[model samples]
Target: EHIKNYSKHIDEFRSQANSQGIWLFISTLGCWSVNIPLIQVIAAILLFCIFIFNSKQDMTEKRAFHKIEEDIAKDIDSNLIGDSRKARLYDLGLVEKYRKAIKPVLKTSPIFIVCYIFYSISFLVFFSNLFPRMKLIFNF
Candidate 1:
């Protein structure tokens, strides 16, 4: 069902968003050491950019799901079930609750976005060879 797909998309995007934060932080930390190599730094910068792009894609997907849910909710509420006042009211209330719950995402997402940008810039400046060196040091 469409609702099921909406839930799935939101869940998947949420995880992607979390990873954006984690990887950005890791990339920033990697740049802190002095002995990290150039290739490793380049790789980390590339990886961070990739993660940021993926996060943006995920956010777009999430917005699509949210819009779909809103449209479906509107369609259901606008037609059919002529006499089920209580049920319709309950559904409307639930929809409003869901909308409110997701509203904080608008605020929170920007903070994460800004943090990621700063992290990427810092990683490029201070840790260009950091990621490759990490692989050897961690024996990965």
Candidate 2:
């Protein structure tokens, strides 16, 4: 019964974590598109909203994971070596789930890095063109 409950809790936490990661990945990309003149204020606002929601989500998942750990610890305190082993296995499963949860973030990390570099270069180009003095410092 405890193991089944543990599995359910972990599954829920995993799903939420992965969903949050997806939102983070989206926001990272959407950052480059933010501009008042470009009429993407709505996207900016939505991204911020998602960020806030994800923050709450992160908290919830953390609490759930912590609760599971505490429950397992209590089981171990009862001197049940079998349950202790099961708890350790469950912990390993959670670690695996976490790795899967971050897949979207890992997959998009390189893309985000590239986009950030390009965005920075483009912004510098625009800035140097608009303010000729800045170009002297950049040595461009």
Candidate 3:
């Protein structure tokens, strides 16, 4: 049961970590999609806020899992029999794999600030409102 909860927490944080990247991608694209700088900035800000919220959630889950892991370790038995023991070991491996997978993203999350800086610079350099010109270009 404890191992199952560990896997669940791992899964939860993995999605949370991925979501931060996904939203940041959308936010970056928003800068290019909209013509008006102010509106683009506003949309980017909102998307970044969502990304930040996910980061916080991921951190919280990480801490919770750590605490749970510590407590579970204290109570785990050395002796176990049959499939129950195999399942517990499998769950432990699964949880560890997910935790490892997300570690790189978490380590570099702050570096994403650099990405936003570059995105803003690009938005300024190539300022185009494609929506307004789409009809003329596409002959709709």
Question: Over the stretch 13-85, how does candidate 3's per-residue lDDT look in tens digits?
Answer: 5555555655676668765687776787677677767766768865645465667766655445465656876
lDDT of 1 by residue, 1-140 (tens): 44455555555565566567776676666655535466566766676677767777756463555576677667666764666645655655554455457564555455456657777566544433345554432332
TM-score, candidate 1, is: 0.42
List clash counts for every candidate, in order: 5, 0, 0
Per-model TM-score, in order, reads 0.42, 0.39, 0.42
Q: What is the lDDT of residue 128 in candidate 3?
A: 38
lDDT of 2 by residue, 16-106 (tens): 5555546556564665555552344455446557756765656534554556656665775565667667776667466546545666445
Q: What is the C-alpha RMSD of each candidate to the true structure, in Å?
A: 9.8, 7.2, 10.4
Query: RMSD to the native, candidate 2?
Result: 7.2
* Residue 89 accuracy (lDDT) in model 2: 61
- Candidate lDDT scores, in order, read 0.58, 0.56, 0.61
Ranking by lDDT: 3, 1, 2
Q: Which model scores highest in lDDT?
A: 3
